[model samples]
Target: MGKASTVTSWLCCPCRCLFCGVLSCFLSVLACVLLTAGLVVLVLYLLFRPHIIHATAVSADLTNFTLTPRTWILRYNLSLALQLRNPNKRIAIHYHDVAAEAYYEGQRFAHADLPDFFQDTGESSPLNTAFLGHGSLVGGVAAAGFRREAAEGARFSIDVKLGAHMKLKLWVFRVPGPKPKIDCPLRLKRRNATAGAAGPPPEFRPTECRVWF
Candidate 1:
């Protein structure tokens, strides 16, 4: 009985050692792979030095904003000039798609699609977008408030929202990622001092947008 038990223990000992050896080898290989991947990511980040794209609403024209309180019908013509800047010195930007919307009192009234283009490193470019024509305002309360403000012949405040999809180019390599939304709150009105003046139309002061990635 003693010899039989000794033989069984000998058999189990070798099997246990073999299983531990294989597991150790696999864990070692996995650790090495993970370390290598982390190093590669670090190197790529240092090489590209990518940065956020800055967008600013430089000017706005809202002279034709009109809203009917009875029917809640709105007729509007709004135009804006945006300044896009690539702040990265080592990377360029390739904008693939851009969309803009104008909102009054939290209600979206107009939208426009902009042409895709490329921006060089440390370059700034202006993009002009216009929202024309009109439809009924979705919210009655918002329309009434907007009408009252327009009648006051003072400033009308609205939000211009921009969304875009872009890629960063470093030399011949391209890195694609999601971009943050831009919100620019702007106030437009006839220069009360020049309201009745026989001269050019009034322009909204430049507005810096809020953005985060």
Candidate 2:
């Protein structure tokens, strides 16, 4: 009986040692995997920081503008150019459902839709939109304001508001977030009446605009 008890003790001790060794190896491997994953996430966050996109109204041309006093209707034809830029070095931007509007003294007159597009890292894209429509003036107050502006050098200042949904593209992952809004105000110069019968169109400069998400 003494010999049998000694043999059982020796067998159980080896079994316990083997079990402990396997558990230790598994825990070590798991810890290494977790550390590696954490490092990868940290690197990605540093490389792809959030950035604000910028837009500007680069140029505008007023071809034909007329206001009918009897009907209180304003008809205008304008060529507007825009510049969109992405400043992020490591992130691409995808824009969807972009809509733009042209306003004169808070009264909207025309609308345009921008094509959905993807902007690569550090890319600038030019967009051209046309505003050709007739809008009825609200009342005497608006008509009076318009006349005042027209008489003052015939200079017309128009405001454009842009709204779109944007997504960030990093490698194969797409991160979705809130929609982006932009407002660009443009100043159009009166045509050069002395140049010729059909004078040159109005010229505009790049107007800095801000983006909000």
Candidate 3:
């Protein structure tokens, strides 16, 4: 019985050793694969040399803007011209989706979806957006502020923002990249935008947008 036990133990020992060897080889190969993948990523990053994108507010036209305090309604017809710039000379970018919004006093009042397009390396394109709808103000405070601004017909300040999902490409390889967020503060006032005024000569100075990923 002791000799039989000894033979069984020896056979089991070889099986255990074989498993350990296979596991060690697999782990070694996995480590090599991971290391290679990391190095490739690093090299690609260096090669692309991507830079920050810029979106500048080139111009704007505000034809009609009115607010009714009792009804909490805001009506605006505003058009904007924004220039989108890609500073990277080697990395092309594709914008899959983009949305533009207009805000007043920290509240979103209107929005529009822009068309999706691709930007070649170091390209610049002009994008136009229009907000021509009315929205209900949610709070009394916002309504009061709108009324106050309308009373004097002074310059109206609107916060415009753009959000998008984009990808970067080099040669035939494409990598999912960071989404860009662009924020621009617009100040527009017609020369005679008094109470109940309608249209024309609204000045929208060119403004630089703050951008982030």
Instruction: Give lDDT tens digits, candidate 3, residues 101-162.
Output: 99998999999999999999999989899999898878888877776776666567789999
Whole-structure CA lDDT of model 1 = 0.82
In model 1, the runs with Cα more than 4 Å from the true position are 1-35, 190-198
lDDT of 1 by residue, 81-131 (tens): 989888989888888778899998888889999998899999998988999
Please give, for residues 1-213, the per-residue lDDT of candidate 2 as tens digits: 999999999989998999999999999999999999999988877878757888888888877566798798888887778889999888898989988888887888888898899999999988778888888877787778778878898887778888989788887888985798888877776565566337656556679977787
Give the poorly placed runs of model 3, Cα more than 4 Å off.
1-38, 190-200
Best of the candidates, TM-score: 1
Number of clashing pairs, model 1?
0
Q: What's the number of clashes in each of the models? A: 0, 0, 0
Q: Per-prediction TM-score, please?
A: 0.78, 0.73, 0.76
What pairs collide in candidate 2?
A: none
